[model samples]
Target chain A: MEEIKDTFLHPVVPLDFQNNYRVGAYLQRYLDGFKEKKILGAKCSQCGRVVVPPRKYCGACNLVMEEFTELPQEGTLENFTVGHVNLEKGQWKRADAPYVIGMVRLDGAANAMLARLNVSPADARAGMKVKAVWKDQVEGEHADLDCFEPA
Target chain B: MRNVGIIGIGYTPVFVSKRKDVSIVEMISEAVDAGLKNTGLAPEDIDAYVFGNMATFEGVNMPHLWATEHMHARGKPIMRFATGGTIGMAAFHGAYYHVASGMADIAMAVTYEKHSEGDAQVGLMGIITPELMAMLSAGIDVTGQSGMGAIGGGSAGGISFQASSYLHRSGAGIEHIDAIAAMERRNAAKNPYAHLKDPEATAEKIAQTPMVSWPIRFGHICPTTDGATVCILASEEKAAKIADKVAWVLGVANCASDATTANLIDSQITDPAEQLPAIMASKKACERAGIEDPKKEIDYVEIYNGFAHQTLMYLEKVGMCEVGEAHKLLEAGELEMNGRCPVNASGGVVSTNSIGTSALNRVTECALQIMGQAGEHQVEKEVHKAMAHGWGGLMQYCTITILGDKPKKL
Candidate 1:
C-alpha cells in the first residue's frame, strides 16, 4: 500500500534528522561515564538524596547533588508492566508493537529508571532481575544497546 | 484556587491537506478571532495569552509571542508551554489561572500544529539519534506521525510498558483493544468536523490495517492534524457579558512527579503518566465548584485520548473510576454519551485532534453544550455541569477543568 502511494507522490526534500536528546547542559560528565561502561548517580549533600543517571541538583532539597559516584547497574525490578501496544497514529494492534517496557530500581540508586526489557512482558514480574546491555563505545553515544535485557 | 469560567471557545477543523488559503500565522488568527468573537470581545479584551505547540515542531524559539502578535495581542502577559501531547491543555491552564486569580478579566489560550511544513514522524523521532531511530520506530509504521511535530512525548518513547500494564492488570485482550479503536473510529464518523470521519469504520477494517505497533493500529492513533484552537477564559464579571450561557471552570489542577525522566538504556521509567495529577486537579476544581463524585454530578466529559491507552489512563486520572479500570468502563459502556457519565461525546482527540489544539476543543465542546448549541452530539440531559481533561507531555502535564451552569459562592 505504501509502495502504491509512493508511486504517484514522493518526498523531494531530505527529511533526515538527528538524535538531539542529550543528558543535560553539561552532559559531557554523564556521556563520558556511559561511554566507559559505567552507571553514574548524583548525591545531594544537604538532603542526602541519591539520584541515579545523576542530576545537577537534588530536586527535593532544591540543592546541588554534590557527590558524584558510579553505582552498579543492578537493582530489583519494582512494580513491572508489559506494554503490548505499539502506536503509529495512536491506534492499537494485535501485533507489530515493540516488547514490554519496565521500570527498574538500580542498587543504591535513588530513583528508578524506565527502559526496554529483552524478556517477554508475559514472563515479566515485579521482582524480576534485569541488566543493561550497553552498546560498544565505538558505536558512539545513544546507540547504547537499544535498551536493557534480561541479565 | 479562585473560580474561573470559559466564556468562549473556538477550534478549527483539523484538515489533512496543507491549507493554502491561509498562512500559518493567519490560520492561528482565524482560531483566536473566532474564540474572541464567541465571547463578544476584541483583541484588547484578552489580558494574557498562552501558546501550546511543542517548540520542536514550530522551529520558532518563541511560539507565545508569535501567536500573541498574530492575534494582535502583543505586549500582554504571555507564556509558551510544550509537553509532548499535553501542551494544548497545559497552555489552557496557564490562561485559566489569570482569570481565576483576578489578574485578568479575560484571557485566551491558543495552540496549533502545522505538520504541512515538514514530516511529523521524523520530526517527532528527533528526540534520540540516527542509529537509535529504530528504537522509537520499533516494529510500527509511524508514517503519518513521522514528520508530525513532537509534543510532550508519551507512548512514542515507551511502547510495551503502559499497554502491557493496562492489559495485564485489567485482564483485557486484543479484542478489547480493538473494541476501543473501533468505538473511537465509529464516534469520529459521527463527528463531521473530525479529520478521519469514516462512518464505515469497522473492527475488521482496523484489524486489517497494517499493525504499526502491537495493539496499536492506524485507527487507534490520532491524526497528524494541522489546525488551531483558542479558548477565552473570563472572570465572573466579564463572563456575565458574554454569550447567553457560561460554563464555569469549576475545577482545575496540574501536578507532576519526580521520577519522570529516564535513561535510554534503562527500562520502564515508572510510566509517570499514571500520576494522579489530573485527578488531583479535578479534585481541586470540584472543591471550588462544590460538586462531589464527578461521575454522578457531571453530565459530559471530553478526555484526552490521543492513544486508546491514554483514554484508559485518563479515565483513572480524572477519578472517573479506579485506576486500571478504564478498559472496564469502556466494556461496561459507562463512558457512552447516554451512560451514567458521557465521555468523549465529541469523538475525542482519538477521533479528531491537533494535539495542541485538541484539549481546548474539549473545553469548547463543554461550553457549547452548556449554551445548548451542540448541533448533533448534545446529550439528552441538560448539561448542568461538564468536565474536560487534557494530558500533555507524556501525560506528565495533566490539567483538569470543570465547568458548570451556575456560579456558586465559594
Candidate 2:
C-alpha cells in the first residue's frame, strides 16, 4: 500500500496563562534574609545539618528545622556544568557565551546550593573555593543571590 | 504474596518524533488494540487498568479520564500515576500489586507520551518556573545571565554535572561515554521498535556530534519520540491459562531520596551520580527476589539510561559491578548484546524515550527477552533472570523489578 500524507488537519494552538503560588514560610524567611544580604539556612536540631533555601522539615532527620542560622558567604564548589545553549521557556537557542554553573557547599552546611558560577569553562573545577555574590539592592527574591564567584 | 506474570506485551506500530496522521486518542487506541490482539484476550479479561504519562507534556491533565473509553476501561477501576520518567514502571508495579494482592485476576498497564504534541522541556520547567518568575518580578537580573534557572539547560545541563561527577569518581573519561553511546545506538539499529537506529554508530562518530553541555553530546541524548507501550499482567492461575510463555514477577521495589539530589544551583545534600536511591531500590528488589548476587544470577540488565553515561553509572550504583567496574566492563565489550551479560538489548531509553513509556519499556523489553519474543534484539545467552530499572522525580526516585523465567518459591 502507498503511504498517505496530508490527510489530517493541522491546527496551531497558542496558550497563555497566569498562575499564582505561595512561597510558604520557610522560603519566605529565606527570601526575607536575602533582602538584608544574609543567607538563611535551616538547622535540624537532631542532625545539625544546615539546609539552604531553608525548608520547614529536614529531609534526612525527619525533624522540624525551626532554628534559622546564618551561613558563611564562601564555600567549596562540589560540582558544575558548562552549557553553550540557553533554554527559554522550553525554547533552545545558542548562548551568546558559554556559561559555568556550579553546586557550592557552604561551610557548616551539609547540603550544597546550586548557583551560577562567574568562572570560565576552562577555569571551573571541583573543590575550588567560591563565594556568593548577592545583589546590592535585593527585593527578597530568588535572584537576590545573583551568582557565585571565586573567593 | 501470590505469584503474578506478564502474559503479553504491545507497542505502537512505530516510535518516532511525530504521529501527525492520527489524533492522540486514535494513536493510543492502536496500542490497546495491539495488546488485545497479542494476548488473544477480550477487553473484559482485563480486571483493571493502570495508566501513566507525563500529562503536562501534552497539555492534557488527568488523561485517563478521557482515555477511559478508548482503553475499554469503562466502569473499571483505573489508577493513574505520574512520577516523571518512572511513571511507566510505577504504573506497571501498581498493576502487579493489584494482581499479586488478589484484588484483580488480571491487569493491564498502559503508558505513552506524545512529545510532538507539546514542548517536552516546557513541561519539565513546571518544577522551577514559579520561583524563576518570582525572581524576575523582584527585579533580579537573570536575563541573559548564566544559571538563570534550572530550566536554562533543561535536563542535559544538570545531567552534565552528574556525568562529570561520575567520571571523577569512576576514573572514566568522555571516551568511555562515547563508546557506550555508540554501543546503544548500534543496539537500537537492531530493535524494530526503537526510535533511533544507527547500525554503524561508533565512539569516534558519537564524539563528532555537537556537545549540548561539557560532557553531553546531541548523540548521547534520547529522542523525544511519540509512542505507547502496554503490558498485560495476570495472576498465576490466569497467566497459566492465557499464554504458553510468561515472565514471572519475582520482586518489585521503589526508593525515594531527598529532592536535593537534583539541586544543581542549590546545596545538594546528595550527589546525583551517587544514586543512593537506585542502589537502595535495586538491593531491596534483589533481596525480595531472593537474589543474593546480581552479577552472577541476572542474565541481562535493562537500565533506565535517558543519557548514555547513565548506563555505566547505574551499572555501578545498582551493584551489578563494583563502584568503578562498569567502565571496565564496557571497555571489554561486556555490555554488548552478544556479551556475557547483555545490557539494554532494546537499545535503551537513550535511543527511544516517550517519557511515559520509557520506564515501562524496560519492563516490557525484559519480559520480551525472557519470553524469547524480542526477535531481532533478543540476547543469545540462556536467560533465567533479568533486572529492569526506572528513574524519576528529579533523579531521586527509582523503581526496580526482577523478572525471571520461573516464579519465586513461596
My TM-score estimates for the predictions, one after another, are 0.65, 0.71
Could you give candidate 1's per-residue lDDT for residues B117-177 as a string of tens digits?
Answer: 5455555444333213332334322233443222123244344345555666656666666
Best by lDDT: 2
Give the TM-score (vs. native) of candidate 2: 0.71
List, in order, the clash count of every candidate structure.
Answer: 51, 10
lDDT of 2 by residue, B1-410 (tens): 89999999889999998876665655676788799889999877889999999877887888787667667787899999998999999999999989999999999999989888877766776653433443344354435344443235677765787888899899999999999999999999999889998999999999999988878888889989999989999999988898999999998999876553342233334465888889999999999999999999999899999989999999988878998899999999889988886899899999999999999999999999999988999999978899999987676789999999998888
Model 1 segments beyond 4 Å from truth?
A: A1-151, B126-157, B259-273, B323-325
Docking class of 2: incorrect
* lDDT per model vs. reference: 0.66, 0.85
Off by over 4 Å in 2: A1-151, B128-144, B261-268
Per-residue error (Å), model 2, residue B159? 0.9
Q: DockQ for every model, please.
A: 0.02, 0.01
**Per-residue C-alpha lDDT of model 2 across residues A1-151, encoded as one tens digit per residue:** 9888875322112234432223456677888998899999989899888989776556454345789999999999999999999999999999999999888999888888989999999999999999999888899999889999999
